[model samples]
Target chain A: MDEKKLAIIATKGTLDWAYPPFILASTASALGYETEIFFTFYGLQLLKKDLDLKVSPLGNPGMPMPMGMDKWFPTLLTALPGMESVMTSMMKKKMASKGVASLEELRELCQEAEVRLIACQMTVDLFDMDPAAFIEGVEFAGAARFFEFAGQSDICLYI
Target chain B: MADFDEELDASGLNCPLPILRAKKTLAGMESGKVLHIIATDPGSVKDFEAFARQTGNELMESKEEGGKFQFLIKKA
Candidate 1:
């Protein structure tokens, strides 16, 4: 039987938004599926050589406040200075305690599993992002290139 | 108890880590060799079943002990 294929379009770059694409791609590859992740717009940030991903609590009603402060924590306070850093740190600590893999670790696993990491060239040109800023082994391509592979995939997801 | 050629302890790790580690271990084993895995993630029960099905490996045994989940898979 032919190997199954999975194609993913990653469009989000936030800390909370990063896990789905990498996790799914890596897992699918392990399941014996050929997998590719097309990084576009903000999602291209994930391919950076140095990752400094951060999460924000503002307008995120679902985010539970840290240190047992959930019930009375004011949404307006999320807009205050340095709130993003505070929330990001809290989330990192919480994930560490839960034994969740970091984005780097997941991405590395994907690479090891031979999952293709494609960076959208248009986004790179539009954002003026330096090509050298991205990690090695990334393929830069256009939407047409992605569609060529995605069209033949048994599963295609936009995340 | 099913005999296993290799053992993987994936306690505390969540979601795909356990499955990913098991796949890596199984890849290094000879065909028909059994891989014993112990994972703490509840999601792994279903994940391992699906993994065995999708990868064509045989899940020789699966059960819970105390608070942990144990699985024995024969490499395909």
Candidate 2:
């Protein structure tokens, strides 16, 4: 059977939110499928060296620590820690312990697996991002081109 | 092969990884070849179940071990 093409549209900017697309795409590639990830809006941040680790705690009441810390100081306490790495590291470790690969490894595998990573040029300018800040091997495209890319996908996921 | 025909040791992988691997592997097989996949990721349990339903893959068996998950899938 011919391998199907898969596309994952990433719009979330947080580290936790960022994992699914790379994970799915890399996994798809491992399965011998053609995979692509179109990063737009906040999703573009994942490719940026500086913004790869920041994540919002929305929908996670148990987040921001101490088990009930969000209630007391609010999730703002998460900002107080000032280290997205601490939370992100813990989260990645948890995911890894569950047999999930780390985000860094996943990204590498996605690249190695030939999962094409495309960044939306419009969103880059909208957010005022430096194209150089993103990881290597990313191509810039407009929505029309992305639509054409996505139209060929057998499975398309938005995460 | 027995009714429980094949086994895939895919422990220590998470979420879409297990299912994606399963799908990729399944796409190449003759129909009705059963595959059993063992995984340590809880998310894979749900992921595989949903994948089976969406893609018309048949899940012949599923189980767990101290946080690990096992599946018997028949390619459809």
DockQ of each: 0.93, 0.36
Tens digit per residue, CA lDDT, model 2, B1-76 = 2365556677777666677667656766789988878787777777777777666778777887677788888987
Reference A-B contact fraction recovered by candidate 2: 0.62
lDDT of 2 by residue, A94-123 (tens): 666777666777687688677889999999
TM-score of each: 0.97, 0.67
For model 1, the stretches where C-alpha displacement exceeds 4 angstroms are: A67-71
- Evaluated at residue B75, the lDDT of candidate 2 is 84
lDDT, candidate 2, residue A82? 44
What lDDT does model 2 reach? 0.75
Alpha carbon deviation, residue A14, candidate 1 (Å): 0.6
Please tell me which predicted candidate would have the highest DockQ against the true structure.
1
Report how far off residue A139 is in candidate 2 (Å).
2.4
